[model samples]
Target: MSDDQAPSTENGGGGDVETVEKSEDHKKLVDFGLDTTVADELEKLFQAKLVTYDDLDPRALEAIRDFPIECAIAVLKQLLADSNLQHVNNKSAYICGVMKTYRQKQSLGEDKPAVTNGPDEKKLKEILDRTGYALEITTGQRKYGGPPPSWDGGPPGNGHECFVGRIPKTVYEDDLIPVFEKFGTIWDLRLMMNPMQGCNRGYAFVTFTTAEAAREAAKQLNNYEIKPNKKLQVNVSIANVRLFVGNIPKNKSREDILEEFKKLTEGLREVIVYAFPDDPKKKNRGFAFLEYDTHKSASGAKRKLASGRIRVWGSEIIVDWADPQDEPDEETMAKVKVLYVRNLRSNVTEEELKKIFEPFGEIERVKKVKDYGFVHYKERDSTLSALEAMNGYKLHEVEINVTLAKPANENKARERRMRRERDNNMNMGYDDYYSSYPPASFGPPPPMMRGRIARGGMRGRGGMMRPPAPMDYYDDYSGYGQGYGYDDYSSYGGCYEDFSAEYSPHPVTPQPPHRGRGRGGHHAPAPVAWTSNAAAAWPPWYAQRSGGYGTAWRGQSWHQ
Candidate 1:
């Protein structure tokens, strides 16, 4: 065909007739590594039902791409034969005939150089290989021969290995070996499994036969989709130096701890601070593990910082060699059944404390002393449930601090005893140590009263002295004059009238009746009857006064 008539597949159109482009389907075919010209022809064929549309699907395209052009033509011829349509009119006939003729010539003992195919044919073969489709056409059948070989011979892992993450859970050893074998010979393939479930744990380890093969696989397959909705993560597997760090401040972040430790040393690969798994903010858990690139660096860091001199967030942290195997043990340790309760009110009784904790679990015992105590539960699971439910809860009007109590130790026991003693001292009173008595006397008691002191004599009932009855001042004054009698004063309205009114130019207003102090110290109007009753309740001496009480006289009245 002339260059002009070769085909204009760029827009999925042919023979000078413009066609409505299915750009999305065309792009999908192209992404599967189909040449534009071939893809357009295949679309035409599928539209005409000359070839099943499913034959040109991504899976089919991937399979066909694995073979060389000659092999692929052979496979197509076999498919035509199987369909009993070997003579069907199609544009692919020329290539198929050429390959058939070549094979016949070879069968007849004639030597010929392999066909020199065009760039388009070469590109098609490359696409097929990369898509992981393998077709064996030599046997006159178009059957997939599994994925193409990664290497011609030998197992992988000669010098390199790769880490694969995000593996699908349904993937198995058989499923992985065949797919990854396309990249290179795999010496060892390990799909990490959940020990309890015996299923894939979403990751794998692949060791390739050659470093170059491993590198190629990692570069080409990183983020490569291996299954529907599951992509592979490929990374170089390196030896890691893990260091254990303890006593980390709970407020310190991974970045902060890394920054502080990085200042002390270099070559840190990664730093991971454990956190409360359920917390959305991921509060730190006061410990962490760090990875280094080399064991020497890790050992050096441990040697220099293990003395607890390396401080992070003003807290000296403990550093030591980390054994990965110990992780499970540490997790087991977290399932303790004892809880430490702090910030309790000193007056909280044991019964009250039991009520606070009994809702969580059956408490075996409660060892409470003053403001802190421990609650031992019947089961570890109950303790965990209670801890999660009751942490930072309010008890006895105080926000109690609750945590998993560490295993008891001698030092902790000593500390507790010391604290108890201190609390005891604080609660003690002076009455507990000394008896009370009257203060030392400064002089002798006063002498007894003299005989015949009063009308009742010196003593009365109950041997107690009694003061003489109040003298009848009214009677005594009554004899003085009729005007001095109490009744005479009462007749004058109890208030002393201004007797000096005649001496003054104007009669006195008799001063507005003395108002009583009201609520909030403000003076209020006094009732007319209250003035007379108040005057009557006053002492005998005050009733004899005239004019308003003076300031000096007021002081003397209060003294009296």
Candidate 2:
């Protein structure tokens, strides 16, 4: 026979060995150097239906690989014996049972006989450690106390506690403890209770015996609904170092307050100063609240500043613990019924102001003084609405300040009135003046008449100089020579005859018309061609100038 088919005496047998053909899977077992006797036994077990090659746990095969073939067979036999079977029914179950026995023996520090050529105590320990089943083998019990280990990577309940928020108010300690105890041992559990209601305050603190427990509980119970509608909020509990600061300066702002406390110590988490409600001035009340990351910083600030005073805005402010239950009285709270308006223009009238505020609500009354006013509303809701709508509203081209009106003080009122009067005096000069009389009646007087002098030095009719004759010099209708001044009318023939006979009752003999010079050397009459049309159509002045009768006239000199 060829060497491949040769029967070996490795099993120490002289009888002719039957060469059994190995399947591909059986060849793999043989290639691992498993003894032929052991393989034969395993094949017999498979045939008997006690175990199958597929049923053998790979982990068991892996665990025994480093052992000698005889030793590996002995381990397998021990497993079967422990299970009270001639062969393992479930190979994987049998392997797990062997591991459990090993662990139990190791934990008890028992010296069990080694089934291998040498002791495998170290190997067994390695297997348990690699599988993470060795926690109990190391730390037998958790140590308590001291700020639990840095929880950075530590498991919950290792050294940390958790804060459970948004818990149902009806949940009590007994109900909460049992639910978390499943995660690990509970060190302590505190559910904040309301003093008056004697019920839970919707939050609690839970301390687990170990960080691992706390972390596990936090992971599973965070946002876990304990009630139908409420869910629990679990988080790592921070130290309680929040403080209440009282007697803050009314004028100090939130930033200013923060800065003040920051001087006491560093690490201030937050600062909140309560302010007067609806105050147009935006002033704060005399109290505040502060928070620190640790209790030490918070307590230090209280110790240093509580017994002493802090000066702000020229006033010494008191510092004390602020009670969370304390609140401003309802009477002191801002109520909308009256609005205080400031920065008003002097020219804004009550009627005009009324129109601006009227749209918000029914105005009970509006008391207006120079640059400020007060609008009283009939209803509180209307007042609030008006304040909201009209605050910072521009009126008369100016942004008026609107706020809830507080009680009037005598000194403040007097000061306001005085200030307004002074302002009015200062700005009155800039305002346009209004007159009581009609505008048209207050202009310059009418212009005077101007005239020129004549060539003979006689003033014109409209000039300041007076004329020689009166305006009525020719009042009579007698013929010219009968007297007033012109004596040339007799030459006009019958023209003067009608006038002379009517006024003198006798006819004067007709004579040629004559011309003569008067006082200024100006001729009294100038001869002209007379016609019957002229005599019939001429006026009294023209007839006199034509030498036909009557005294010289003194109106504007007429030119023919």
C-alpha RMSD (angstroms) for model 1 = 42.2
**TM-score, cand. 2:** 0.22
Q: Estimate each model's TM-score.
A: 0.20, 0.22
Best by TM-score: 2
lDDT of 1 by residue, 1-560 (tens): 54322434343224555442343454566567765555554455454554654434454566545435445544443333333222233324423433454456557774342322111334435544664544322212122222235535433321256677787766654455556678865555555544223245577667666666666777788898878878888855532256656567667777887888888876666775434323325445455667665545767787778655666667666554442110111343466676766555667777877887898889976655334556778998888888888878877555666666544223323433343345334543324311221122222112333331211111110111211111222211111111101111111111111111112223222112111110000011110111101111111122112111111111111111
> After TM-score superposition, what is the CA distance of residue 167 in candidate 1 from its true location, in Å?
35
Q: Which stretches in model 2 have alpha-carbon errors above 4 Å?
A: 1-240, 309-316, 322-560
Total colliding residue pairs, candidate 1: 6
Worst 10 residues of 1 by lDDT: 518-527
Per-residue accuracy of model 2 over 193-286 as CA lDDT, tens digit each: 4422324556766667576677688779888888897788775543334464544556778788788778866657677543433343544545
